[model samples]
Target: MASGNDMKMAEETYSGFIGLVKWGTILTAVVAVIVVLLIA
Candidate 1:
């Protein structure tokens, strides 16, 4: 019961952390591309 909920919460937090990293990398790549275009 409590352990199950704790496990679920831990998984959710890990996934959220991964999602933030993935999106952050993507956002940085996109901004870099835009800057390159502007420079060119």
Candidate 2:
């Protein structure tokens, strides 16, 4: 029972981490493009 709960928690955390990274990368790319446009 404890192991099952732990597995669920880990899976949630992993998914949350992936979500953050996905959004973070997208945001970073957008900001970079904006900066380049402004500089140009």
Candidate 3:
């Protein structure tokens, strides 16, 4: 059904968004650690 397909698409989009946020946070944390080490 079209409605079922639409729901699947929405779920995929939501998953991708969460993945992006998680990766962004991890990257930021890594960068922060590197900067701190460099400055020290």
Candidate 4:
């Protein structure tokens, strides 16, 4: 049984991780497009 505080902390960590991953994916795609354009 997890305590309320522990659950809240876990949720916050998960949200932050998700946000990081979302931004990372967007950055990767943008960089890829730029690279392709430079090559072409």
Q: Which candidate number would show the highest TM-score if scored against the true structure?
A: 4
lDDT of candidates 1 onward, in order: 0.97, 0.97, 0.97, 1.00
TM-score for each predicted model, relative to the true structure: 0.75, 0.92, 0.79, 0.94
Tens-place lDDT per residue, model 2, 1-40, is 5598899999999999999999999999999999999999
lDDT of 2 at 24: 100
Task: Report the C-alpha lDDT of model 1 over 1-40, residue by residue, as the tens digit.
Answer: 5698899999999999999999999999999999999999
For lDDT, the strongest prediction is 4
The TM-score measured for candidate 3 stands at 0.79
- Could you give candidate 3's per-residue lDDT for residues 1-40 as a string of tens digits? 5598899999999999999999999999999999999999
The deviation in Å at residue 11 for candidate 3 is 0.4
Model 1, C-alpha of 32: deviation from truth (Å):
0.3
- Model 1: which residue pairs collide? none
Models ranked on TM-score: 4, 2, 3, 1
Q: What's the CA error at residue 6 for candidate 3, in Å?
A: 1.6
